[model samples]
Target: MKRAAMVVNPIKIKDMRLLHREVEQVMRRHGWAAPVWHETTIEDPGFGQTQQAISDQVDLVVALGGDGTVRNVSTTLLGSGIPLAILPAGTGNLLARNLGLPIRNRKVALRAALAGRDRAIDTLFVEIDTTGDGVADESAICTVMTGCGLDAEIMASTSERLKARAGWLAYPIAGLRHINARRTPMRIALDDNDFEDERPLTTVLVGNCGRLTGGVRLMPDAEPDDGVLDVLELSAERASWAPLITQVLSASTRTTSQVRHRTAESIRIECEEPTRVEIDGEVHEHALAVRISIKPKSLVVRVPRSSKPS
Candidate 1:
C-alpha cells in the first residue's frame, strides 16, 4: 500500500481533526494508507516537515495551507519526483488558483488532490542578495510568482493583524498607502542579453503561472510547464496606475506602452537602492540584486487531468 503525508497549517483550518478525517477517508478509499499528519509550527512553516516526509519515502504529500506553506513544502520536495498536492486553505492560494484546483470546497479539494494526475511543473529558482552588512543570501523555489518594487511594497505594508481579519481585502487597504511612491531605478539582463541601462522601474515580476489573486492574469503567456519564465516590467508615473489597475482587475492582457514583457529562461536584476522583494506573496525586507532562473519540469504537482491551464 502507498503511504501519504499531509503537511497542514493548523491555524488556517478550524477543525483539524475533521480535516484529517476527510483526507484519511479519501486516502483509504484510493488504496492509500492512513496519512502521516504534520502540522506546521509558527517557527517552521512546513519546510522541515516536508523534508521529513520525503525522507520517509511517502508516495504522495498533501499540503494544506496558504501559498507560503505550499511554497515551503514544494521547495523541500523539489527534484524528489514525489507529487505534491495542494489543498487551498488560506487567503492567496495562487498555485491552486492557477492549477484550477477545487479551492472553495474542502472535501472536493481534498478529493481532487488525492485523485489527480502527476503534472510536471517548472519551478523558479530565485536568489536574492541583500544590501546590509552580514546579511546572508536568500534562496527559494517560487511556485507561482515573485516580484520587486510596488507589488513588494504593497505586501510589506499589509499588516498581519489586518490580513488575519480582512483576508485578501487587507492587501488593497494597505496598497492605497503606497500608491504614490516614486519609481525606483533598475538595471536588468534577460538571458544572454547585455544589461539594459538604468530605467525607472515601477515593478518587475517573474512568473511561473499567469493568474494572480482575484482571477487577475498578470502574465498572459505564462505556463507552469513552459520551461521558461514570463517576465513583466512596469514603468509608469503615478497617474498611469489608474488604467493599469483597471486592465489588471478586468483580467485583460492587452499591451500598454507602460508595461514591457518578455519570455526568458533566466533574468538578473540590480536595483539602484535597496528595495523590497517578494516571492509567492511573502515579502522580504530588502534586496540589492536578484537572479532568477527556471528549472524545467523540476517539481511534480498533482492536478486534475481535465483541468487545462489558461
Candidate 2:
C-alpha cells in the first residue's frame, strides 16, 4: 500500500509500545510511508477516526481492535472504495476469524494485512425501531452478524471486568448463568416470504458470514459475498438446547425441527415484547422490531492471499 492509516482500540492492546514499534518497523521495511494512527475513545470506538482516514485518502485503513471496531470502520468505509485490513487485538475477533486471517501471530497478521488480496464483502443495513415511533427509521450497519434473544443476553450479561481478564470465555460463563432465561415470541419474514406468526424463539441471527469465535460455524452455507443474508432461528424449548448447543459447538449443519434456516436479501422481525439486540457483538438497546437488508459486495477487505472466501 502506498499510504495507510490505523484505527486502534487502546484498551484492548496489552503493549501499545511494542505494537507500534513493530508496526512502524514493518512499514519502513516495506518502504511504505508512516501510517497515520488514530485511537478509539469510549465515546467513539472507530467511526470518526475511520472517517478521518477516508478524508485523508489513505490507500488502506487497518482496524486494530475487535468486532465492534471492524464494524464501525467498515460502516465508514462503505462505498469509499478503500480496503480494510484486520489486525485483531481484542476478544471475539469475529470478522478476522471468519476471514481466515492470522490471529495468533502479530507478524503474520501484519504481513497478511499489508500483502494480501482484496475481497469484496456484503454488509447488512439494520433499521431499528428505537424511537417508539412505531416506524423503523434509525439505522446502522452490521459487518459480521446481528442477533437478538439469547445471544444478546450472553453478550449483555458478560461482565466487562471478566471480559477484560478472560476474553471470549466471559460470554459463555455468563451464558451458563442465563441458560434457563425465557425465550421471546417473535414474528419474522424473509425476502418475499409471508410473515410467520409470533412464536417463542431462543435466538434469531442474521449473518453476512457464518463463523463465530473459536472456529464455530453457526451457518455452514452463509457466504459474505453471496448477495444474500443467512438466517438462523432457534425456537426450541429450553430443554432442547443441549443437542442444539452440541451441533453449534461442533460446527455441524445437522439440525432438528426446532432449528430453521433461510437465505434472503431482506428480513423483517418483530417481537411480542421488547428484547435486547446486538450487532457485531456490540449490544444495542432493547427494540420491539428491526428491518435488516443486505448490500451485496459493498465493502472491500484485505485478507491473506491464501484466504478462502468468508
Candidate 3:
C-alpha cells in the first residue's frame, strides 16, 4: 500500500468533512490505505509541515488549495521526487487547469488527484535581489510562472478583501484601478540579448504552462517539461492601450498580437526602480534584478493522460 499525504488549505471551499470523505474514499479505492492528512497553517508553509510529510515517507504530497499553497508545498518537496497532486480550491487554479485536471468541483478534482496519471514537469528557480546589495537573498517557485514589472505591481496592490468577495474577477477590478499608474521603464535580457522598452505594461509574465487567470492562454506553445521558459512581454505605449485591451479580452480563449514573446533557457530582468515580483501569485519586494531558469523535469506532477498537447 502506498502512503499519501494530503495538505489542504482550510480557507478555500466549504464542506471540509465532505471533501475529506470523498478524498478518503478515493484513496481506499486506489489501495492507498489510510492516507495521512495535513492542513496548511499561518505559522508554517514551506518548511515545517512539508518536512513532516517527508519524514513520513509518503509516496505523494497532495496540495489542496490555490497556487500559493501549491507553491509552498512544492518548494518544500522539491528534488524529493515525491509527485504532487493538485486539488484546485484557489481563485485562479491556473496550474490545475493547465494540466487538464478537472476543476469544476472539488469532488471531480479529488477524484482526478487519486486516479490521474503522473507526468514529470519542469520547475523554475527564481532569485530576487532583496537588499539591493547585488545579491539574491530569496528563492522560490516551481510551476506556472514568475515576473517583475507592471503586472507584479498589480499583484502587489490587489486587496485580499476584494478577492474573497469577487474571486478571480477581483484582479481586473484592481487592474482597472491601477491601469493609469502602471507605466515603467524596464530592461529585459534573454540569455544575454538585451531589449529595453518603456511602457505601461499591465504585467510581464513568464509561463511554464500556457494558462493564466480566467483560463487565459498567455503562451500558446509553452510546455512545462520542455526545459525552456516562455516569456510574454506586454507593452502599453501611448497608442498601445486599445490593442492591449483587445489582447487581454481575448486572452481567455486566444492569443492577442499586442504582446511580444520569446523563449529561452534563462532570462534576466532589471528595472529602474524597486518593484514587486510575483511567483505563482505570491508577492515579494525586491531591488530590481531577477534571474529565472528552468530546472527541466525536476518535479513529478499528476496530469490527465489525455491532457492537451503542451
Candidate 4:
C-alpha cells in the first residue's frame, strides 16, 4: 500500500473526528495506508509540515486548506517529484477551482487524489523589496495571482466572517466599496525591457493562472503551464469605473484600452508610494517594490482524468 502525508490546516477544518473517520475509510477502500497527518499552526502554515512529509518519503502529499495552504505545500514539494492532491476548503479555492477540482465534495476530492491523473503546472517566485534598498528583504511563492494597489486592497479588506458567510461572493462584495479608490503611479518592466513610467493605475496583477472566484476570468488567456506570466494593469483616466467593473463582471477576454494585458517571463514593479501587495491571499503592508518571475511547470498536481489543460 502506498503512503501519503496529509497536511491539513486545522483552523479551516470544521470537524476533526469526522474528517479523520472519512479520510481513513477512503484510504482503506483505495488500498492505501492510513495517511500520516500533520496539522498547520498559526505560526507555521503548511511549509514545515510539508517538509516533514517530504522527509517521510510519502508517495503523495495532500494539501487540505485554502489556496494559501496549497501554495505553502506546493512550494515545499517543488522538484520533489511527489504528486500533490488538494481538498479545497475556506473561501477562495483559486487553484482548485481553476483546475476543475471538486470544491465542495471532500470524498470526491480525495477519490480524485487516489485516481486522478497528474499534471505539472507553473508557480511564481516573488522577491519583495519592502524597504526599497534594491535588495530583496522577503521572498514568497504564489500558486495563484499576486498584485498591488487596489487589487491587493480588496484581498486584504475581505474579512474572514464575510467570506464564511458569503463564500466566493464575498470578494466581489468587498471590492464594490473600493471601486472608486485613487490609482497609484507605477514604473513597470517586463522581461528584458527597461522600466517605463505608466499611467497612475488602479491595480497591477501578475498571474500564474487566470481564474478568480465567482467565475471571473480576470486574466482569461493565462495558462498555468504556459511558461509565461499574464500581466494585467487597470487604469481609469476618469474617476468613474463602471466600464472597467462591467468588463470584469462580463468575464470576457475582450477589454477596453483602460485595461491593458501583456505576457512575459519576468515582471518588475515599483510603486511611487507604499502599496499593499498580496502573495496568494496574504497581504504585505508597505511594499515599495516587487519582482515576480515564473518557475515554469514546477508543481505536479492531481487533476480530473477527463479534464484537459492546454
Could you say which candidate leads in lDDT?
4
lDDT of the structure predicted as candidate 2: 0.86
Q: Candidate 1: lDDT over CA atoms? A: 0.87
- The TM-score ranking, best first, is 4, 2, 1, 3
**Ten residues in sequence with the least summed lDDT for candidate 2:** 247-256
* TM per candidate: 0.94, 0.95, 0.90, 0.96
TM-score of model number 2: 0.95
Off by over 4 Å in 2: 131-133, 250-255
Kindly report which residue stretches of model 3 are placed more than 4 angstroms away from their true locations once superposed.
Answer: 193-202, 237-239, 248-258
Give RMSD (Å) of candidate 1 vs. truth: 2.1
lDDT of each: 0.87, 0.86, 0.77, 0.88
- Residue 92 in candidate 2, Cα distance off native in Å: 0.8
Q: Kindly list the per-residue Cα lDDT of model 2 for residues 226-265, writing each as its tens digit.
A: 9999999886666887877886777666656778778899
**lDDT of the structure predicted as candidate 4:** 0.88
| Superior by lDDT: candidate 1 or candidate 3 | 1
Give the CA lDDT, 0 to 100, for residue 259 in model 1: 77
Clashing pairs in 2: none
Model 4: per-residue Cα lDDT at residue 221: 87
Error of 1 at 146 (Å): 0.7
**What's the C-alpha lDDT at position 205 in model 4?**
91
lDDT of 3 by residue, 216-247 (tens): 66777787888899888776755667777677
Cα RMSD, each candidate = 2.1, 1.8, 2.8, 1.7
